[model samples]
Target chain A: EDKVVQSPLSLVVHEGDTVTLNCSYEVTNFRSLLWYKQEKKAPTFLFMLTSSGIEKKSGRLSSILDKKELSSILNITATQTGDSAIYLCAVDPSSNTGNQFYFGTGTSLTVIP
Target chain B: EPEVTQTPSHQVTQMGQEVILRCVPISNHLYFYWYRQILGQKVEFLVSFYNNEISEKSEIFDDQFSVERPDGSNFTLKIRSTKLEDSAMYFCASSALPQGYRQPQHFGDGTRLSIL
Candidate 1:
């Protein structure tokens, strides 16, 4: 079975503080990794990492993948109260059948004012 | 921006009853998927549909669960028999292509199903 594990299940940080969330996975055929942000309802797409070393960035958020270690990290710099939300990591494994996406129990972030 | 839309922001049903959740994915997207998240739990994959057929499904998707494109724009998930365990937030997602490496899925605001 494909498995994904995220570290620091919960984090509490003050506004303007920087935080990093980690995700590691074990799969038979790894194709790509994706990150999502969930506030109260639906999750919104963040970044999809396919290659290692290169970073994908959007505003204050950036993520990088390490294929050699089978892990990825999401960094949020100068975080604001609006950035407080669950950060989810999912992996897509290569299969002859349809694409299967496995998600890690997300890291819940709480940003204090 | 185009978004996937789901009807009935919330639904309450009795056990053993049948329920159909509706969704209309982003126009022009070819692949569709259904996922669920129990409160305080990880989001689980239920099924994926493409080319008017089922491309993949998880063990959670048993005989009681069925999906259909039914019409040109709507995708539906029907649960023949509901259980208390079935209470969760069901999400509909769509992507422009089948290849994960090419297109990432966009999710809808999910319908919260409460089974009594």
Candidate 2:
């Protein structure tokens, strides 16, 4: 079965600390990988990585995809309490019929001040 | 910036009763999607709609569930018979592209459904 797995289901870090989140997937006809930050009720768009080795960055957050390893990583530098949230990883496979996103369990990060 | 909106922040219904979740996607978006997240569980894809028809659906989207674009701005998900396990946070999302390849999906705040 196609599955997306994320490591360190839960993490606790102090303010100013840096963290790395991992996501690995085994799905057919891979198209792209997306990262979202879910706070409270909504999952906000963070980054979309379609090419291998090229990193997508926004402010203090960045992500990279590795097609060969079938994995990706999200890095957050200078973390703040505002950054605390459940980070979600999703993979969308190339298909002619339609697009369905396979999501991971998500990594819950709590940044303490 | 325009965002997806869902009505009724919470809904409580009895088991076996029917429930309808409403959503208004971004005006220019071409693809619409529905997803549900059980407490402490990952978000699961339910269905995708485009061109006023269902483009694709997941295994979880069985006969009990149905989707429709009733008007130009409204998208609805109807659950024929609610079950205890049906209690979850249902999210509505939209994207400008069909595959959402480079364009990411924008999500709403979500409606929390409770089945008694």
Candidate 3:
């Protein structure tokens, strides 16, 4: 089975603190790794990482994939209260049948202002 | 920006009753998907559709569940007989390509299905 594991299921930090969320996965044929921020009822798209070493970033949110280690890390710098939400990690594997994506339980982040 | 859309933000149905969850994917996207997230559980893939046929489905998508694109703009998931455990948030997603190689899928807000 394809499995994606996220660490520190829940975290609390001050507004200015920097946070790092970890994701590790085991798949048959890895294709891409994606990050999502879910607030309220819907999950919004964040970043999608396909290659190792190269980091994908959007403002204060940045993510990098390490294929050699079968892991990825999402870093939030200078966090704010608005950044508080459940961060989801998903793994996309090469499937001839179709595109199959597997998700981790997710890391709940609470940034106190 | 174009996005996938779902109807009936919340639906409450009794066990053994049938339910249909609807979604309208992005007009230009070629592939569509259905996923569910149970309370306090990980979001799981249910099925993927392309070329008017089911391209892939997970174990959770059993005989009781079916999907159809009866019209050009709508994708629906039908549950023949809902069970108490069938309650969850169903999300619809779409991507520009069938394989979704490098294309990121856009997801709808999702429908909350509650089976009593």
Model 1 interface CAPRI class: medium
Per-residue lDDT of B21-81 in model 3, one digit per residue for the tens? 9999999988999999999999999999999999999999999999999999999999999
Q: Which is the better candidate, 2 or 3, if ranked by DockQ?
A: 2
Candidate 1 vs candidate 3, TM-score winner: 1
Show the lowest summed lDDT stretch of 10 residues, model 2 chain A: A92-101
Give the TM-scores of the predictions, in the order they appear. 0.98, 0.98, 0.97
Q: How many clashes (backbone N, Cα, C below 3 Å) per candidate? A: 0, 0, 0
Per-candidate Cα RMSD to the true structure, in Å, reads 0.9, 1.0, 1.0
Runs off by more than 4 Å, candidate 1: none
* Candidate 2 regions with alpha-carbon error over 4 angstroms: none
Per residue, candidate 1 scores C-alpha lDDT tens digits across A39-79 of 98888999999999999999999999999999999999998
User: How does model 2 fare in lDDT?
Assistant: 0.94
Clashing pairs in 2: none
Q: Which parts of model 3 have CA positions greater than 4 angstroms off?
A: none
**For residues A31-82, could you state the per-residue lDDT of candidate 3 as single tens digits?**
8999999987767889999899999989999999999999999999999999
After TM-score superposition, the amount by which residue B2's alpha carbon in candidate 3 deviates from its true location, in angstroms, is 1.4
Task: Please write out the lDDT profile of model 1 over residues B1-116, one tens digit for every residue.
Answer: 99999988999999999999999999999889999999999999999999999999999999999999999999999999999999999999999976554688899999999999
Question: In model 3 chain B, which range of ten residues has the least summed lDDT?
Answer: B97-106
